[model samples]
Target: MTPSPATAAVRVRRAELSDLDDLVALEQATFDHDLVSRAQFRRHLDSDSARVLVASANHRRFLGTALVFFRKGSRVARLYSIASLPEARGKGVGTALIEAAEAAARQRRCQSLRLEVRIDNESAIRLYERLGYRRIGPVEKGFYEDGSDAFRYAKTLA
Candidate 1:
């Protein structure tokens, strides 16, 4: 049976242990040397402080993933990782995931969301800027495994 276009539209939801392999593949596809290993994904999957979300078409075709970390007794949530598959770039997958992350944070009583993006990621920077996230601090040198610098971005949720 053919699937409806609406059904195929990217949908963002919490990641599950069953999505381990897909999440790992997404990490590999999204980053080079600094890939998060399977064990790390496993830990995040089980962690109370972390929320792993995935964007998929029809709930089966993986398109992207986002990992958010929350601290107990803290109002700030960190967007630790977010990436869209190369084939899914510019298709609104990233935006959907970001919106989902923000909703999750707000639901958890977080007052704001912060993330670090590589300085060279112009597209991502543009997306964040368009979404109302602002640069908050000095550049973080050698933040990535490949020695790339990063820029911190923050968005108030309240």
Candidate 2:
């Protein structure tokens, strides 16, 4: 049994077609803009270079999801999106997803993982930093749907 963000054991695994609803639900519940559509989730689940990982407990309730895009002909994997239930914050859901993403990237022979977080998302920034991801590039202007800027971050895989 996997431990849930709240109390149960959490399990991280590759997403399946049945996971579309939960994936969309998490996407809608997490970000205010640039949401991942149901069609997109299906496409990602079928794509070879894209991965949608889900974290759940007892295969019942979902805890979080992470979307990773692997660049062809490149050693970089992009952590395009990652989000956990509000109650899952600071409960290792994000960390588990990140670790799974890193493993997925490494399995694909990726050398580094990269992502962009809204400049105003201090908690996310702190999480990335705490996980050893360093700021890589300049803050992107008008990055989000609400025109919020974003900070680029990256971490080299061992």
Candidate 3:
């Protein structure tokens, strides 16, 4: 049988130890360079300063994941990473994860949500802009392991 489309319906929640494998697979499949290591993901799961949100269809099959990082004595939250399966692209999986991240940031009293996307990620750029993120222009040169430039974007929370 075919899998459900993430856009049809999605469930977003905090990542648990059981979700480590799926999260790692999604990250590996979604990113080519600057990939998040499994060890880092494990650390994030147990870190209070970070929120690891996972998205799934029917609360079973994993569709995507998003990570939000918070720092003490700061009102800004950074969206460290996000990933979705190829079949989940153009669906609501990515959007749902991002919104979840924003909500998590707000819960932590963040004034804004910031992220850096690869320069070549036009699709992601469009999505971020559509979600009300303002472009902060290009970040440091060769920010990725593959020497790719990245663009910074942020959305202020009301």
Which candidate wins on TM-score? Answer: 2
Q: What is the TM-score of each candidate against the true structure?
A: 0.91, 0.91, 0.90
Query: Candidate 3's residue-wise lDDT over 70-127, tens digit each?
Result: 9999999999998888887787888888888888898889999999988888999999
Residue-wise C-alpha lDDT for candidate 1, range 60-87, written one tens digit per residue:
5688999999999999999999988888
Task: Please give the distance, in angstroms, between residue 11's alpha carbon in candidate 1 and its true position after superposition.
Answer: 1.0
Candidate scoring better on TM-score of 2 and 3: 2
Estimate, for each residue in 35-146, the C-alpha lDDT of model 2 and write its tens digit. 9999999999999999999987655467899999997898999999999988878887887888889889999999999999999899999989988999987889998889
After superposing candidate 1, which stretches have Cα over 4 Å from the reference? Answer: 1-8, 58-60
Q: List residue ranges in candidate 2 displaced over 4 A.
A: 1-8, 58-60
Q: Each prediction's Cα lDDT score? A: 0.88, 0.88, 0.86
Model 3: residue 67 alpha-carbon error in angstroms:
0.9
Clashing pairs in 1: none
RMSD of each: 4.3, 3.1, 4.4
